[model samples]
Target: MTVKDIATLLDAKIICCEDSLGRELHAACGADMMSDVLAFVKDQSVLLTGLCNPQVIRTAEMMDMVCIVFVRGKLPDENMIELAIERNIPLLSTKHRMFTACGLLYSNGLHGGATN
Candidate 1:
């Protein structure tokens, strides 16, 4: 699905990279632990997380993720937004909790990447 589709599906607020909303993302992974994301995520372009920090953006960058969905209405600070913008990753905020958000995407045909 496209980034715009995910935003629409979740009713999320797009915080940056609106220009890239047309980008297509085939997979998603939801996690609060950066370590787990770093260790296990593979080829997932969208990240769904409750963690609202700069390191989350960094972790997404390391995983080559193109978009981030902040669950439970969590919003990243300016620094985090700057980092995401610099990395060309779109940030989205959703009122849904982590589990609900993940389920929404999954039920809509967004699958998780393979785990090691």
Candidate 2:
């Protein structure tokens, strides 16, 4: 699915990188802990998380993620947004909680990435 599709499915608002909505995303993973996200996510282009911090953007950058969905209506601060913008990663905010957001994407055919 595309980033635009995800925003529509989750009822999310695009915080930045609106021009990149056409980018295709193959998988998604939701997490609050940066460590788990760093360890488990592989080839997952979309990250769904409630954690709002600069590290979240950094983690996405490290994982080569293309987009981030902030769950539970959470919003990232200016610093986080700056980093995401610098990294060219689209940021989206959703009112749905983590589980609900993940389920919405998964049920819509966006799967979790491969696991070891």
Candidate 3:
């Protein structure tokens, strides 16, 4: 799926990189802990998290993630936006709880990341 499809599926707001809505996304992983995301994610993926901090953006950058989805209606503050902007990662937020959001995307064919 593309970023626009994710935005539509989760009712998310695009916070930056509006031009990236056309980018294809192959996988997703939801997490609140940056460490776990760093250790687990393995693909050109998008992150779904409730953490809403600058560190989340940093982690996404380190993992080469293309987008971030903030769950539970959480919004990234200015610092986080700056990080995403600097990293060229698109940011989005959705009101759905993490599980429901992940499930919806997964059911639609977005896998979690590669394990090998």
Candidate 3, 1-116: lDDT as tens digits: 99999999999999998888898999899889988887767884899999987889989998888899999999998888888888889999999999999999999999886863
In model 1, what are the clashing residue pairs, if there are any? none
- Model 3: clashing residue pairs? none
Give the worst 10-residue stretch by lDDT in candidate 1: 107-116
Task: Supply the global lDDT for candidate 2.
Answer: 0.94
Candidate 2's TM-score: 0.97
**Which regions of candidate 2 are displaced past 4 Å?**
none
The residue ranges of model 1 lying beyond 4 angstroms of the native Cα positions read none
lDDT tens string, model 1, 46-65?
99999888999999998899
Q: Which is superior by TM-score, 2 or 3?
A: 2
* Model 1, CA-based lDDT: 0.94
Cα deviation at 99, candidate 1, in Å, is 0.9
